[model samples]
Target: MSVALPRIDAIRDAAARIAPHAVVTPVMRNARLDALAGAQLFFKCENLQRGGAFKFRGACNAVWSLSDDEAARGVVTHSSGNHGNALAIAASTRGIPAHVVVPEGAVKAKLEAIEQAGAVLHRCAPNTPAREAAAAEVQRQTGADLVHPYADTRVMAGQGTLVLELLNQAGDLDIIVTPVGGGGLAAGCAIAAHALDSSIQMIAAEPEGADDAAQSLAQGSRIAGITANTICDGLRTLIGESNFEALQQHGTQVVTVSDDEVVAAMKTLWRELKLVIEPSSATVFAAVLKRPEQFAGKRVGLVLTGGNVDLEALPF
Candidate 1:
């Protein structure tokens, strides 16, 4: 069976559904960073979003999309970090339970936040199959809905709302870039961005070590089973099937950057933009720096995906 992708209408509905819950995160600019990249950059500060990430938008949408009866059974999902925390928080607002199947060795701060948000945590081996199996078991046991971190259409529509807000805030961007993990955010952004203004370019910034999105796009098939070795823990997952389909449909472009470059860009954002974004979030900035010719003098919108860094484990 073919997967149904989120469309512009669905994304618009999501914007309305999640409006009361999600933040209209600020758009920031730094003259110094603009000069450094030779581009006019607008940073959508999702670092300051609720749950400290854009993951909340999708999670909130998924949680609330359920019927009251379905929500009573609650929601379950697998995540390295951000999505779990977002789901937990989103579920709480609706007075429902949340079961998160988190990988072993997932970010400590994120795990703590998930628990703090009142979600039950299930530990799994740090791999895709293991995580999915654990989440399935939880869903089977609890009769909860499985909100696949990126693949679910509702989740993708929720993620797309960010671009809707970005375009409304930043007006007439030449390019919009987002970090791609399971490709939910990028795919969603692609759908929304193209619908609003097909002239605007949509780019996915990826870690070179976990470049499955790039490889998948290049091969014209969803690539799987590559061991992710990036320091960006939030972005180590393979691209989701539905997300890949959306990307293919929208002709989204992919750009890869190294961990060293990500760290450099993270520091630059902290120093220049005063943003405490994590490694995964820094990939967009690193991509621009990596390919200045593509962005130079253009109005580039960068989605700073999250700010959930383990201060004690700073890469610098």
Candidate 2:
């Protein structure tokens, strides 16, 4: 049988490697949001993080953990927004070249951010297979290490650092909730939260249009061939193979919200908290709106993943 699971100690080490580049973002108590969720909600405002998302934590760690030979080869990956810019920034800090493959429909602001961070960007057809194939080709061309946006162990471990910091900021949280795309952050959350307290309920919030995690959890099997059709472009993908296995084995829960609900949450965070979060980050924020009972009166944690919204691209 496979081993129990990766140790949180490894993730903690990754956190140490990335702390210099990543910010220890504040965990703000939002009374209005807490009242809506019927719980004491601590919003981890990663929207204010460097490179405009929590991906910076993982990207920085992954890049820094590279050996000198690997660093000389540089790094590469495919991402719609946060991860691409994050890797670009991380590689820039190390004076290493970075190559990023992006889908055609990727948000313009994200594309600009990646370019602004000094990464060479290559456009690909907007599909899972094409994106992966394009990224693979870039790696072959550049000999860069393929730093998968979500599936890499180093990246997942680095993402776990967020929860560790959150736990340090606020002790004894009842639950931790975050938006799940390919499961990097969710995997990190599961590893970090449960390692600290096996009782901490880690919930992943997703958009209904691309609710692969929800469907997979219910079906009890890995599901592929499903197309992502969500306005939350950051969440428009299925979980990674190992990520699905981890989620199922760990009993991680998944919740979903509509695109409209995400939009409403975005507006709420902006209006009430004055934070300009993206549609994907709002997915977890919208979770409380849908399932008020589950989080009611609990010390709940919400990871606001990013703030890379292009004002002109707002659906309103």
Best by TM-score: 1
Q: Write the per-residue lDDT of candidate 1 for residues 1-316, one digit (tens) a residue.
A: 1357888999999999999888899999999999999999999999899999999999999998999999999999999999999999999999999999999899899999999999999999999889888998998899999998888888889989999888889889999999999888998999999999999888999999999999999999987657899999989988888888887888889999999999999999999988799999999999999999999899999999999988899999
Candidate 1 — worst ten consecutive residues by lDDT sum?
A: 1-10
TM-score of 1: 0.98
Q: Which digits, one per residue and each the tens of the lDDT, describe model 2 over residues 231-290?
A: 898898788877777787668889989999998888998888888889999998799788
Give the Cα-based TM-score of candidate 2 against the true structure. Answer: 0.97
lDDT of candidates 1 onward, in order: 0.92, 0.87
Candidate 1 local accuracy as lDDT?
Answer: 0.92
Q: Which residue pairs collide in model 2, if any?
A: 38-297
Which residue pairs in candidate 1 have backbone atoms (N, alpha carbon, C) closer than 3 angstroms, thus clashing?
Answer: none
Please, what is the TM-score per model?
Answer: 0.98, 0.97
Off by over 4 Å in 1: none
